[model samples]
Target: MTKDPTLKPYQLRQLMCNSAQDICSKGYDEESGWGIVDLHGAMEQLEANYGEQLPFNDVAMDAYYVNAVNWALKNGITGGSTSTTFSPDMTCTRGQTVTFLWRAMGCPEPRISANPFADVVENDYFCKAVLWAVERGVTSGTSDTTFSPNAVCSEVQIITFLWRGLNCPDALGRSELAAGLGEHYYTDAVAWADTNGFFSVTQSSFNPMGEGIRAKIVTYLYQSLGRRQL
Candidate 1:
């Protein structure tokens, strides 16, 4: 059977808002001081105003933001300050993002064996968590030899990590993935992501080369945890 076209922008926004509300109701209280800014609004405005400026920005907020924040808040993936601000626009560092995902997955904290990166000292708090991610194959850093813990993670990086962490199965074949992905290092990542219904290349190309925005990362994580409804 032929598939229907993707949901319109408004419909996607409603889905996100509903999802966010459900998540907030599920014991994930909005912090007191931080402004619980409407990610839906931010996402919508970002798309309506900046669609042509960026690739990922073209997707509707409803399609992505509510789900992302819902999952992040519910799973303790992101803890807002007393002010209740999520700081969604702030660029996420590799260490910070990985820790959030680790906590969300209920992964245990293991002892650090050694500092793999020359720049990351053993005494660093993120050292063990970073090591855990590496050992688990959730992340492999920029290269075989370097972790780049301080680097700001992009939208693609975080989504790929989420996909790996969830152990989503791969797509049936190379043709199932978007064209040109066969040559990407994240070919398996995209294939697995698509097969699992986490996303679609037809609706929006995975853009694996792009950086992950905070809202998008949160949405993918929430979906990975199977908590999109709440």
Candidate 2:
């Protein structure tokens, strides 16, 4: 809707499927790409967002993380790595992930507990974030004495944090990975994720221990924002 801002979603679907009036094919085919455009048909069919655009030069118009990044920025979750770069593929730290979630939840001040991690200093950027997370049970830290704020947050950890931040709701059904998966800290989180339509049909298993990238992190947040009250 950027161009006209008046076109409805159904009109856009019509434009995608009925715009093409194929001269070469009797029916839709892979080679024909639906058909050729019928501008008249599109004219017959026919509806508006935020600081949806980011200043990051690397971000494309069609990037999947667009809404997430925009939502994050509009709510002050991030300012990018710099004025002109989002670095969407960069690995996100545990500290950054918690901070993102904390910001998304409107930056609530921690009502209880002090910084228990020896590694987390009072002046650190993630210091308050860690405190809020600990008070809310979003995480317990890597150990009693270390927050490991700089550690690479893996995919499962991100899911677990998000789940706990929402009070660890139970899933009604088992995840597709239920049989192959063993018990772990994030098992229930993964199951809840699956119940919420987070995985694709072919995605039978997840690389839970793999590093979480900025793109995936934002995508998950965006999807959660859509599917859940949080």
The CA-based lDDT of model 1 is what? 0.57
TM-score of each: 0.59, 0.73
Q: Can you write out model 2's per-residue Cα lDDT over 1-230, one digit (the tens) per residue?
A: 65567544433553445345765544334466456666566554321132235789988877767656765665477868889998988999989999988876657677865667999988888888999999989998788899899999998899899989877888868776744578888889988877776654213346888888887777676566545320
Itemize residue pairs with steric clashes in candidate 2.
6-47, 7-47, 8-47, 19-37, 19-38, 20-36, 20-37, 21-36
- Alpha-carbon error at 67 in model 2, in Å? 1.4
lDDT per residue for candidate 1 within 1-230, as digits (tens), equals: 01214544433443343334332223222332112436665465445533232123323445546545644554456755333455555677898778877766554565557655776667875676788788778887677667788898866677677767656455656546545565665667666566655664124566566665565566566554453222
Query: Which candidate number maximizes TM-score?
Result: 2
Determine the C-alpha RMSD for candidate 1 after optimal superposition of all C-alphas: 10.7
Worst 10 residues of 2 by lDDT: 44-53
